[model samples]
Target: MSSMLKASVQIDARGARFGALITAIVFSVALVTQSPALIMWQAAVFAIGAFRGPQFTPYAVIFRSVVKPRLKSNPIFEDVRPPKFAQAVGLVFTIIALIGSLLGSSVVFSVAVAAALAAAFLNFAFNYCLGCQFYLLGVRLVSPRNSKITLEVK
Candidate 1:
């Protein structure tokens, strides 16, 4: 695995965990009547983030931005590829949720919300990245050439 992917996975776990916990709390407290605005906002954020690719590249940019001796000596993040599998999974889920929401299916909406929560928890609780796994599985199944770039962690 590239160092960037590894570092982002660690950081994403943190973001997902925190984001999931708060969303779940809000969901449970409000029950089935949770605000649609909040739901859409969160979903949009995830979709956008997934689409745009890694949001944690700043670490690399920061490292490269400065010429200080200490900054140059430090090695916090490795040269890693962005987690494509995770991004694809998130994108697919987002698309599904969007379609369901448009169709006015409460069940679909709920599932989408739950999926997001699960994703967040999965990252934080188990450090099991469904996104990365999904992406890898997808690439392997669809394109052999693409699979060459995917990292398999043992």
Candidate 2:
């Protein structure tokens, strides 16, 4: 095959995880308090993250501008796409939760919020992103032989 490259934006893993942590906390609070307002705020964040890169999210912006200055470790970069995909997943769940809340169906809202919290917590605590895994699985299944994708930090 001819040489071809697909460049991907490299994201700082630490920053992304920090955002995940914030997301987890937000989701946790939303679930606990059953606050539709908070959930709406989170959904906006997820929408921004999904449409833009995770690096562009407000949480990530905070990490980059504030928390990052205190850390001594080198920045770790990763593909930008996966996080975006994860945000989309989060958005989906968040929308479901919102729908449930608006419809006065506590069960649907609780379940959806809990699921989102679990995913965000897993990513933050274990550095394991569930949505990213799904994306990777899809990629593997669709393009087992495709090696043209290359990562480049912007």
Candidate 3:
């Protein structure tokens, strides 16, 4: 990958890390209220994590911040998919939520809370990004580019 792209990833990941922090704060408050506001804020956080915006925002932030630039320059590391792993986490969490919702288990909500906290913690501390990995492996399976062992970003 180009230096510019690697730099971009770092910047974005840093920003995303901050954003995740904000989301964590918001989530903590919302949990007490069980308010609709929580859902809105959570959606915003996911949006930041999932899409490119006016700024590098969420996903890019994870990419940019979690890994070193020199490491990012390596072809193997450059294509590593954090987003895809995040997606998988979300999907698995959602499935649990769905089942719990169907069964009317209040514990499902609690489980979800734990999962979200884990994800944010993983992002903040370990730099283990699941979202990018999820996008790369789960969503892009049909793409020709993803079919290859090596990814060509350009």
Give all TM-scores, in the order shown: 0.53, 0.84, 0.47
Q: Rank the candidates by lDDT, best first.
A: 2, 3, 1
Q: Is candidate 2 or candidate 3 better by TM-score?
A: 2
Candidate 1 on 1-154: residue-level lDDT in tens?
6955546432333333334444445444423674455556545555545665343333223323443234423334311233434444545655566667778876776787667557655654666566455656766788746444455541
By TM-score, how accurate is candidate 1? 0.53
Q: Residue by residue across 1-154, what tens digits does model 3's lDDT show? A: 6866666342334544544565556555645554444545465545544454413444345455564463534332333235433533544554554456467665775577557666766776677676544555765676656435555443
Minimal lDDT window, size 10, model 1: 72-81
Alpha-carbon shift of residue 146 in model 2 (angstroms): 20
Pick by lDDT: 1 or 3, better one: 3
RMSD to truth, every model: 9.6, 8.3, 10.0
For candidate 3, give the lDDT of residue 26.
53
| Tens digit of per-residue lDDT, candidate 2, span 86-110 | 8999999999999998899999999
Best by TM-score: 2
Q: In terms of TM-score, how similar is model 3 to the real structure?
A: 0.47
- The CA lDDT of each predicted structure is 0.50, 0.89, 0.51
